[model samples]
Target chain A: MELAKMEALIVDDHPGMRTAMRLTLSNLGVTHSQFAQSANEAIRRIKGQHYDIIVCDYNLGPEQDGQQLLELLRHNNLIDLSMIFIMVTAERAYEKVVSAAELGPDDYLIKPFTAEVFRVRLERVLQKKSAMAPLFPVLQAGDAAKASELCNVLAASHPAYMIDFLRIKAELLMGMGQAEAAQQVFEGIVSERAVPWAKLGLARTLRLQQKDVEAESILEGVISESPEYLAAFDTLASVKDKLGKAGEAQEVLSKAVAISPNTLARQRMMGDVAMRNGDITAAEAAYTTIVEKGRTSFFRDPNDYVNLSRALLECGKNEDAINRLREGRQSFSNAPEAVFAASVMESQAYSQMGKAAAAKEALGRAMALKDSVPMTDELKLDLATACYRSGDEAMGARLMDQVVRNRHEDARLLQRVRKIYTDLGRELEGEQLVQSSTQAVVNLNNQGVLLAKQGNLAGAVELLTEAAAQLPNNQQIVLNAAHAVLTLVNREGWNQDLMLKAKRYLEEVRGSNATHPKLVQLQTLFNDVQNKYGSRV
Target chain B: MSGQDEALLPAMLAASLHEVKNMLGELTLSLDALQQQCPQQAAQIEEMRFVTRQVSDRMVQVLLLYKNDAGVLRPNIEAIPPADLLEEMLMEARSLAGDRLVVSLEGEQAPPYAYFDRYLCEMALMNAIHNALRFAHSRIVIGVGRLGNALCFSVEDDGPGYVPAVLQRAIEPGGHSRDGGTGLGLYFADRVARLHCNNAGECGRVQLDNAGVLGGARFQLILP
Candidate 1:
């Protein structure tokens, strides 16, 4: 709680900043501070030690900026709530600063600041962290209900921390799947003051309640008033996509990318949306930026290159497409999925160029590599298309069947399968295959749910878990399996092996759709039961 | 110039300014360490620190001017408590003045909150406080209060008030003092004040007047 007792890390590529910060900390009687000259070094230092405070410059030379580094830490669950993160940036870099707001740093200090100002800002951050000290330990220990209660009491009594406590309370409720309670808190905060973040939170709560039209309008107002709010753009685009307005989502993502092109996630989103909407030029441009800008960071996904090549091939740039696929394979040589996708793309490009021998060779390599990597619905779709185009209709149909059996409820994928069959002039056969596969999976899911509803928790869990293992790519089935496990544990008491199985399914679902409502529900239920009954393992 | 080249010009200027500021900061730190070792030369060291701060402040003003000229200067507004704002300025003054002058904040009747760009407002206020500390006979006071609907924060000194010509030039746009003062600080403070606008279409403004609570020169920034 005291400045002298705190351990601090200063991250800046500039020696002057490092020296200046050391001097300032020395003035405050702090002696155990460390300095890092780059983001990579900062990450290494942080991983090896615990720092109470981090003073990071916004720009850290040519690699990942402070925001991207923070994103990586948060995505990997590396940062705990107790540590204070202060982003130091220069004046006139308002766009980046605004964008960083969503990353949830403790505070930001504009550059060209004096030691006195630094002390003030640091003290403020410390005071706020002290106020939040009691809640984080409870929440991190997986006690959401107790944490929510503590926040309610704190917000009711502490006027200074009322706003902050309310904001935390809302987020906790949202994480606990109590959307109505979170919506109430967000609405109260918005009515008291027209803060853009509070309004955006309210929109998210509305979305969770399936009031998407109202959420869209609220997001529109927030975005129009605060054009620099990148998170609002992302949420609005999702709302548009859910409403079946793919064009609007693409436009929203376009605006966000224009404002802050350095963010790789937004570029990927723009590329995906463009490809889905059949805008080959836009898809190619977005993926091009993603591959080029993400090359230096851990965010570089081989899929961006593969997708770009596909867009190019569609646009009739066969030579450029082939080059892209080759470069992609070189960039992500260790990732089997990336290599497989690249090989598939290569076959597609070669076949489009009328090089049948080359296409056949590429297809052979892809089929050999496919068994070594975990199969996802998206990858299977790509491989199936490539197989069909290479004159292997039987193998293509088998792969399509695998995709359908894995996700019978995915109407969009079913449509794609229909189009593929129509292209092969076997529409009737394709329809029969789709109907039978979807019916079989649907019957298994219904029976499991029925077993759970009839109080046969063990039977339901066994059936669904086995089914999910058979059809690993089925998100709905995995989610249901987790739910069944959670209910069984809640009623029948703790079982360590079953708990691990549930956690695995929840994690798998999160990997594919992190924001899915069903995944959130299952996650909350699983954590609640585990926290209530201590883990035996 | 093409659009890309034009944009690069400002970026290069900002980067160069940043490098120079860092060097100045390092020099200030070394001087501070030097003063601790050689207490007899503390006055001389303080004078050097003052000069360094002046240079840094001028560079900041030039960068701000360029940003405004390029139409890229937009305030990031935040709500700051009055006490915290005043305390922050006093800290900077203490670092600059050392033991040569006293600096304090007076906000007994000020409002609880003020909405403005904290970074810009602090720079403007620090410049005024630094100027006052130099001219003050022995003490400077930063006064915070409400003037009608606008919030006013002023820096006042106990030394002789600003002369008639200096006071006249201070308020006028593009006017410099005849006594070798560039008056960039005053111009910058004025511009920062005018950049803040309230929902009622009221823009912030600056006032320079003699005979304050300290019976000396006063620089006040009033924001709506």
Candidate 2:
């Protein structure tokens, strides 16, 4: 409560709040403080003095909000490690809270406050800080285990701080895969009232448990109600995209970007969707944004460069696309897949730009460098285009066969594969290849039906699983496989590989149908699997 | 900067007021700290403190009106605890009201956090506390926690409550109550409340009504 010991900096656009706040602080025994009228001045004051506290307003100016400024300070590590940063805000905007929370400030105070209220709020923050102060060194050192122990000790003693403490404990439990404990904690919050974050957190835990339908539904509910909740939108989009609803996912993600343009991952996601849907313009827009904005982010994925550059090649911006990929390859210290992707992209660009000879030459080098990159079905689909363009009909046909085979039961992917082969004047081959894979897929479905009818559940599961492996994108193969296994699983209860195989196949099914028809039954089986085999994943 | 510059005069006025508001905030915090260091000189600093709060309160009021037009005022409602609401409101009230007022807790303690736009509610209470501090001759009292069917909060001043005309206008966002206020504070509050309100049923708001303790104004916000 002594003003002499406390050092503070006040940042606000309003001179009067600063004055009144200063006078009020004086009356309450806080005398020494610095003042800044705007964010620019605040940054200057922050640099000039090591203030014990910083009071910033949420709405700073036209260009930079308080949240953005705080991020800048944090990214730069301008504040001392122990600095008690607080934002003086009056706006109760959700975007502000999310952005504020995302930035991870120490504490924030709203405007037009009296001395008594200020003291109480400060006291609460300081008390929380004091409790954590002893363990701060370990936390600062990034020792989660030690910090968890200290926090756990504090939590057990202080039930008043249980909510805050358990929030951290739940995160640790989640991180440690202590699902049963974390579930009880989350369910406690849920039974009382729905905390969106806790709900989402639990939903994430369910996702880790491979309960895609439950996770997707929770995220969707949050998204529908809180349209501006960007994270929820992203999560829902991710679930949808993973579930093979690329179009729906694209629409939702596009809406999120419209609200608050996702700087990196969202852009990459959008680009991937655009490519899948064959909207080269959108792919270019999203990819270009990611390449420009996310190059320096810790969350930077080299796939953005690869995907965006590929889009550019598809749109016939060969030189620009190749250049972007080349620069990205040099800049990013990522996996070998990135380098391989660059080579693939470069080869595609060269061939598309009418330099077929150069294209093969680059492909030769890429193939030589890496024995073979297990190109994703997406990459293979694109690479087939370059191969066809380079006049390698046999090679192109072979690659197309694999792509079509891998995604046998996926109508959209099948259609896409057909279109690719069609564009290359290989309609007959594409149709024939898809027919073979599709027939095999149809056989597995029929076998499962007959076996289940005949009570040969084991045979039904085995045959369906083989069919699913042959058609990674097929839901029916996976759905029936899980169904057959679910039937067999109870009678033949939790055999490791069989349940694991069933689980893997179910994920593929869920990846194609986030809300699959047979998901509820499958979840019960998954729960059984977890109960039999502890939550170790 | 646009070609139809004359039509944008109001925007310029708003921007100017924003700048003035920033100056008021800087002065308020700086002087309060100075006043604390020089506690013996309370008589000399009270005028500065009063003007600081007045200017800040008015500037905040103006900004509240302008906020609806700004790009960042999107309200996302959540199930907020009454205690969280009180905590946010209390922080704002104390910071802007100065040492002249006493903001405390009252009523049965509800959940600490609520499902409301925490940021928006904070803004509304700030303006309410500023008004309380301006009117009360000696002391202003704020009691928060909960009251009735919903979590009720009140900011009471020993001074007289709102006059009828002003009270009516205060209900409307951007409403001008007596040539004195920009009337933006209450208007913004109403808009903010409506944002959280359900069109299917019920209202979510920060309202200025009778404190029930005295004939003083009580700003009650109930979120369902």
Candidate 3:
């Protein structure tokens, strides 16, 4: 952590600015420095080597700016809390840049700052990083419980960073699904001072506890007072969406996008909200922006292409939709899931254009490729739409039943299913399908839980394991199976086969939804069981 | 102006100012490089750098004022140690003053941390230091202390203080003194100060007086 021993990456497109930073770093005893002329180059260098300090210019040519680069680095786990990332901005209106960033840099230095100021800010961040260094490993290991406990210890030890530690503790609590505990922490901070971030955190905790009305009011005040706080706008939009005000949510997102249009996730969210509101024009615009911006970004996903194509088809632009899918096919040719999605959307577009023969061909291709990849709910719904449109009603119904059963708890997806069924004049049948599928899953889950409570761990394990096998994509069932197996192992002994089965189930659920609320608890339970009986197993 | 034009004008100005600030930033960096390469002429180079930064600061002031007029200027507040902030100001002030004037903190002690927007407060205080650098005959003292429940940061110089007209303008809130100077720095300081409000609903303010520890102009940005 000594300045002389630290490796530094100075990212600025302008050679003069880079040289300035290099000279500045050398003066500060940071001799081991590397330079990157653009965000892409910086990313490449960062991927190759570890740096103690990264000084990135805000405007790195035309591609990803410093804020976006920070986001990408954090999102991809290329950087951690230990590294110092300082954003250098020429714009004095840096609030816009700061607020737009979902993951902000450790600190920001305005352009033309003296070497003295730079050193101070760098040392300040380094002090903070060193202070919280102990918690980073625990957090990286996904031990939220230990991390939250460490936050309290660190808070008591590092008085200067008490607020920061509390903030992290609250966020960790929220992530671990302890909403009430997180709310208390946020309330403590809010009572002390109405910091915008703390207020936003409080609103989030409230929303987590289903107090959307209170959350919405706080968000409105935060947004009104700090309009540049883009996170507030995003939270408000979600709160509105949860309250069943899709149109209002779309409007809020539109305002947020207008303020800061470079965020890909926000644009994707706007597209989704607009789609839900049945505003095809707005959806198309948002998705188009995502497609264009996502081309060179690491945050790009295959869903961007599929969503764009879906938006185009919804707008009756069949040729455009086909062209988009073709483009997606070219870009993601090696990705089976992407190819499957493209083929499915292509079939829908062709069927809408009355190309029955071509539609059938695309549907056949999609069905063949579907088994090659794990089917997501979105892709399943799209494929089901294609099947229904191609006059394969039975296939469509089957896909719908699987989707409903797998994602029985997702109200939004259920709404989409209902909408699709209603559009096809099969509302009654759709209701029946949803009710039966939901009831079946509930009964299976309840039976396992009841059996386990009644000292029937063996029965619970067998029942839930079979249920998981039948609904391989069902996160709840897989997690339930993992929980049951872990509990059985914990109570009795570690049976090798059951332990392996539980591990596989946990892995499957994690692969689908890594941030599932129950994931950390189940993972901890699994680890505990392994530690307890690994020698015998 | 049409309503559309009225809305577009500030954005256009902001964009142009942004471009100019960027160019000035490049120029300042080049000046820093020149100063380091030619240490003998560091004073001249530092002067150029100071002017470049002053221009950049002025541009930012105008941009912030425009944002305020457009109702978008919200300060990002945080808990910053006052002593650390003043230490940074001292370093920058010493660099700008070079071998000409002795710039120092008022006391050897550190002040407690306070809640304010570091960037805005830095800009405002640096503006005060720059003015003091221009007018101070021998010394400039920057200090932080408490004014009632508010945190007060003062920049005092050993020279003649502000004139009557400027003092008059300071007392009158929202007074636009279109006279000798545009008074944009003081206006920006006022705006930034007012942006910070305490839990008691007391807004921050700027205080100007001839009573200085250095017997010169004393400018204090008092933030609640």
The number of the candidate with the highest lDDT is: 3
Each prediction's interface RMSD? Answer: 3.8, 5.9, 2.1
Give the Å shift of residue A425 in candidate 3.
Answer: 5.1
What value of lDDT does candidate 1 attain over all alpha carbons?
0.81
True contacts kept of each: 0.07, 0.04, 0.30
Note the Cα lDDT for every prediction shown: 0.81, 0.67, 0.84
lDDT per residue (tens digit) for residues A255-370 in model 3? 99998798898999999999888899999999999988887776678889899998898879999999988887777664788888888998989988999999999999999988
Give the per-residue lDDT digits (tens) of candidate 2, residues A1-537: 244688988777778778877886677676888788766777777777778777677777654567656766876668744677777676434245563233446666655455776777666667666655666686567554455677678866654455666667666555444555666677776654455666666676676566778888888876665555676777778777767788888898899888756346567778878788888999899988877766544345666787778788777788998889887887776357778778777888887777878899877666664455556777777767767777777777777776765667567778888887786788997889789867766776887889889988888877877766666666666677777876787676557667677666665665555445456456656656556655311
For model 3 the local lDDT of residue B163 reads 78
- True-vs-predicted CA distance for residue A316, candidate 1, Å: 3.6
Best by DockQ, which number? 3
lDDT of 1 by residue, A1-537 (tens): 777898989999999888888888879877779999887788888888988888888889876778777767776667777888888886546433654356657777766566767777888777767878888889788766688889988766654567778888898787666778899999987765556788899999888777889999999998887778888999999899888899999999999988778788788888888888989889999989888877766547777887788789879899998888878888887477777888888888888788999998989989999988865677687788888888898898788888998978777779878876786578998898899888888898999999998989899999999999988878888888888988999999999899889878876876665456686567668767977896622
**DockQ of each candidate relative to the true complex:** 0.18, 0.21, 0.41
Query: With candidate 2 superimposed using the best TM-score fit, by how many Å does residue A366's alpha carbon deviate from the native?
Result: 2.7
